[model samples]
Target: MSAGLIDVHAHWLPAELFGLPSGSPYGAMRDQDGELFLGDLPLSIRTEAMSDVNAIISDMDAHEISLRALSPPPFAFAVNSSSEDYIDEYNASLSKVVTESTGRLAGLGLTRLDDASAAARQVADIAKAGVLAGVAIPPMLRGASLDVGVLRAVLRSAAQHRLAVLVHPMQLPRPEWSSYYLANLIGNPVETATAVASGILGGVLGELPDLRICFVHGGGCAPAILGRWSHAWQARADVRAGSSIDPRDLFRSAYFDTVTHDLAALELLASHAGEDRILCGTDYPFDMAEPNLPAFVDSTGLDRVALQRSGKAFLGVRVPQTELQ
Candidate 1:
């Protein structure tokens, strides 16, 4: 299948944002600050010159990827600690870069969810910016619940704008997770698990039935543990009292990205979530991503038709057989 694959998950950071050194340790850090601590990878390798739009295009040409959806570097998510003026300037700069890559690439805009109306207005503006296909928001904003008035307001406005939500988790506690290196190994997955758990248990999905949300890292281990959650709910009154709806049903309504990094894991995700709910993802410019991603996905157990249709449907594109494969 040499069809034009559309990667729904990837990240890019322009070099300009990180030239100055500024960011916090526990809170979200900027590219430059992260580079200083995490070493040269953030600055020297993952930025514009290193990521190389031309190189990505060449790689796509060889791999047959027609479209790629770009995300801000994970560090950009931490910009909430900066001034609102800085946030606006940062977003505008990102929008300009992404829009220029319009034909071959699309992007998801980022927003701080603390102010619902301002967030809603940003959503509307990004939609009209003619660059972004969706909005990427942190799973929990400042300590706000998914079903809270603020989040619901933003979601309603997102729904009105017909934007999909790409939910990623901010980094978690460092002390308890530090020893085990669990911040990513365990903490990241747990953060997403808790977010999905909260959304379902709180009945947020039921409220906004039409909203489209895509979960990264194969929904961060939600599929593997959903049954345990269900059993606990049945056995405990307090758990059952959280919401009347079933957690499994909510999982079905959402989507997952194919960044699991193993054939068996991918097969398990498909079994747990169904084929139609899965889409391709590479987590690009990160060392953890597959070296030859398109070929790896091509060889997965997924039905070719399902793989081809998933991205097109997510982007609202009508894929002809020739265009898709």
Candidate 2:
């Protein structure tokens, strides 16, 4: 019952770091004031208080979270911004906040996939500076997959540095899909699924076996379709012309976060991704995610050992001693 409560997937938006009317990968600019404030989080759930260190501690205490690994806003993943100044400013600011939040907070740095090498170097620098556990990169940047030769090198460099990779969807705008609210409902997950799957099927996993990848949003439905993919790979010879890895083989090598709210859904994700591959996440300060997520996860029919192994210990992060305060 007493597991190290590590929220492997949490977020922070220090006002000093990012300004208002921000761009979210979800296709909408967070209006200076909105409920689903930055990153599709609901107002009732995600609050401005997230910017306050003390308030964050209080919220974590209420949820029994011991250590929350803070993820940057998906929009910030473009570490290779149009401006070099952007990269320098973002990294310096991020390093300051993360380094100063010792004992209570840690960060998963974000970088632009388009320039993986530069991003990787920045991540290494951040790691050396301290207070960062990993780096977050989207599957694609400007429509290029991580499987591409250039980007693969970026991934390898990250592995060399022993930095964990958090892969999310790129926040791109699509006017056509806006009408149906598809940007988030389907588009986001679809993006995640495609990027991660491409890296696996493209032989990136085989090439760099030591890479530690944690997929967000329950791997964006990757688990559910893996069997079909595996069957196709075996049934059709050309299905894997360039890559030798069986589709299912790729799934086993990566890690996934249990951000899915549905219990049955979570269980199915675990079944495919496996208990060892699964970790707990709440996507704090987001409306789509509940505040009392740990309780909801506890309510699932998972056994104590399975829960501890899959949810906490495997992530290697300790639970907070008190909620945000």
Candidate 3:
């Protein structure tokens, strides 16, 4: 078997997901054009490709990518007013896509953030259906904290079922984010770091050691800012009261993907998060996705063997057996 690259942070939606009236009445998303909008702001994604797995596979082939860990684009999870039929349809469609892909694709599931029990059930059900890479989540669902009991229930269930967690931000942090694609560039990392800290500072990471999570966008500066976060934790008793452990000391439980789009950022992520905690990723079919992951890895200053090892440990991707030798 030949060595293959796993783009672990890619996004995809079942074709049926698009063009449907949102239960949340996300009227902006249902404008008949199938375009993406963050906080009612339109994005530039080509809606047609989102539902087309063949187009996605062609993209993988062109990029020499063997497998992509597909997740519902963040918008899908924003459907706060979803119906059971809607949720079931989304999960089943995801499983169907992965099942038909013949090992070229794996998927993550979408769940409700407002209701933890429902989210837990969704996670287990999706896992039972063989869609096991993990489940898709936003940094903060609506305005709730990941550290809250409701979200904790979901993580605990994730631990029980052995499903990985993947985090993305649902919307930009501020109205100003509408300018310069700031949501994807700035809000994305900010949200990731904040969510990761909830696990680290909230004691959830220590409680659920079996849980595995991969943060997209090179962990969005969490690796770059550990020193600041650590200092704050030490300088303020209030901050220390949150986790009491050094900020740098506990993030070994966290995993990150190589979507930083900067070689320097990738190096910082590997060093800060540990080389093994970093995995291959490409936010495919989106403008910000790395164009050439193989090339990015080759030039990131980290050794190929170590990076590959780290990705394998974090993702547990099953490459062809011939390559295992």
Q: Cα lDDT of all candidates, in order?
A: 0.67, 0.66, 0.73
**Stretches > 4 Å off in candidate 3:** 19-42, 303-309
Ranking by lDDT: 3, 1, 2
Per-residue alpha-carbon lDDT of candidate 3 for residues 1-325, written as tens digits (9 for 90 to 100): 3356767788887655664325443343432366654446555666655768888899888876777788877767744654567667777788788888998888887776657787778777766765566787777765655677557777888888878888876655479897877876788888888887887888777778888877788888688888888788889987777676787877877888888888888887777778878888888767787888878877776555555555555555566654333
Model 2 regions more than 4 Å off: 20-47, 79-82, 303-325
Models sorted by TM-score, best on top: 3, 1, 2
Two-way TM-score contest, 2 vs 3, winner: 3
- In model 2, the worst 10-residue window by lDDT is 20-29
State the TM-score for model 1. 0.85
Tens-digit per-residue lDDT, 1-325, candidate 1 = 4567777777765554443213523432245532322333233343432235676666667766777777765656643453455456656765665567646776676765557787788778877775567777666656664666556666777777777777776555668887655777777677777777777777777666777777788888787888987787778887767677777776777778888877887788787778998988877756555567767877896655576688766755445567654
After superposing all C-alphas onto the true structure, candidate 1 shows an RMSD in angstroms of 3.5
lDDT of 2 by residue, 121-173 (tens): 76677657655667777666656777874456667877777667778665455
Which run of 10 residues does model 3 get worst, by summed lDDT? 23-32
Better of 1 and 3 by lDDT: 3
